[model samples]
Target: MKAAIFKGPGAVEVGERPEPVIQEPTDAVVRVVLGCVCGSDLWYFRGESPHAAGSIGHEFIGIVEQAGANVRSVRLGDLVVAPFIYSDMTCPHCRNGSTISCPAGGSFGNGTIDGGQGQAVRVPQAGGTLVRVPGSGHSDEVLRSLLALSDVMSTGQHAAVMAGVKEGDTVAVVGDGAVGLCAVLAARRLGAERVIALSRNPARQKVASEFGATDIIEARGDEAVQAVLELTGGTGADAALECVGTGQSIATAAAIARPGSVIGIVGVPHGEVPFTGTFFRNIGWRGGPAPARVYIPGLLDDVLDGTINPGLVFDYETDLDHIADAYRAMDERRAIKSLVRVGGI
Candidate 1:
């Protein structure tokens, strides 16, 4: 088997590794069909993530190659989406829709489990973590979209949902990366009347519009704030999604929303959140590493039904042998998202 590993800053390598097998009764082996790099992976690729140099991907969809005796929710030959983290669905936290906080949950490539960007990998808590899509086979396009359900789309939806986006509420998405663009789509799907996307890149702005962004702000800082405020008729957006995970983006979310609005942080925050006026303004802050397992089931239906095309975010695809280029494509911003085909599932 071959899997991606973090070598150092600006480096990733695809190399051979031992094949994974059912190591526990709760485990299942997944034959990864499609996998994509994530923005969070940038933290590692750029030497920004503290813990690097491990198996390096977490978002993917695959076919069930084998299931442990205790796993019952899926069986051999089932197509499934594996969220970024593995959690026992039976846990109280998962039952209440917080699988990310499940006591026994853990992320892939975190030293305990191999990451998903490989030919095959072992999945823990298979019954609770893997969402079995209804079908036998699907198109490459559909598979790519279903792959988004594992993380990118689900994370974007979580940001909107946490921000309390309502039928008439305005949404300001503070980033133009794949997650942020998907946030625009998610906000609209949830019925937001307006979606303001903060992006200076012409390409991203275009995709943001296609995804449902009603407005685009090309400025940054207070200038961006004023733009969002003016666009919303001076009241500001009802909710803002900070999808870049930078202090500046978070600040924009804090400054661009109306008082008493919610600001969701879906980006993996890199620095301290400036809790200054944000605390005094009664502006609620919500969302963190999304509980992707909880959101995938419903998002799966949308993808399967063709109601959304979040996969548009993926602009590059390659086989596992070219995985290094996949990382470079994302790091250089050559592609909004890069997909790695593991096998012909």
Candidate 2:
């Protein structure tokens, strides 16, 4: 077997590794068909995320090669999508629709959770964590879109939901990365009348439009704030989403949110949130680790029915042998998202 191992910061190598096997009654082994690089994965690659030499990847779609004795929702030959985090699905947190924070769920890789960026990987709590793809043969578009359900798409959807976006509401999204772009689409799917995206990248701006954004602000800080306000007729957006995990992005989200409006932040914040004036303005904040596992089922139906094509975010694709290039393309912003085809399902 072959997997991409993180050697250190700014480094990754494709090397031979032992294949995974079912280790728990609730576990299942998957033969990875397609995987993609995530924005969060960059943190580990840049030495910003806490990790060591280990399998790297979380968002993936694959075929079930084997299932544990207790697994029932999925079986051999079923194509499924695995969320970045694994949960037992019966825990209180999972039952309440917060599977990502499931008291029993843990992250993949890092020697605790099995990482998915490889030829094959083991998934725990398979019955609850893996969503079976509905059909047998899927086009590239369907496959890629289904793969997005594993993480970025669901994360984006969670961001919008947290922000309280409603029908006819004006929604502004900060950041135009894969997650951010997906947020733009999610806002539309959720019935937002006007979607405002803050991004200077022309490539991303184009995609934002396709995803239903009515406006694109190519500025940041005060200038960006004014742009969003101008679009909202002197008022800020009714809801705003912060998809970038940085101090500046958070500030911008807060600045562009209408007084008493909500700002849903999904970015893994590494810095302190500036709460100055937030309380006095009556602004509300809601967001945390996106429970992607909870949203996969409904989102999958949309993908299968052609209601949405979030896979448009993937502008680059390659096989596992060129996995390092996939990381560099994303790191350099040359690609909105990169998909790696490890094998066929």
Question: Pick by TM-score: which candidate is best?
Answer: 2
- Give the TM-scores of the predictions, in the order they appear: 0.97, 0.98
Residues 234-255 of candidate 1 have per-residue lDDT tens digits of 9888999999887888888888
**What lDDT score is found at residue 188 in candidate 1?**
94
Q: For candidate 1, which ten residues in a row score worst on lDDT? A: 47-56
lDDT of each: 0.88, 0.89
How many clashing pairs per prediction, in order? 0, 1
Residues 39-110 of candidate 2 have per-residue lDDT tens digits of 888887888877878788888899999999999999899999998888999988899998877776788766
Clashing pairs in 2: 109-113
Q: Cα miss at 150, model 1 (Å)?
A: 1.2
Candidate 2 to truth, TM: 0.98
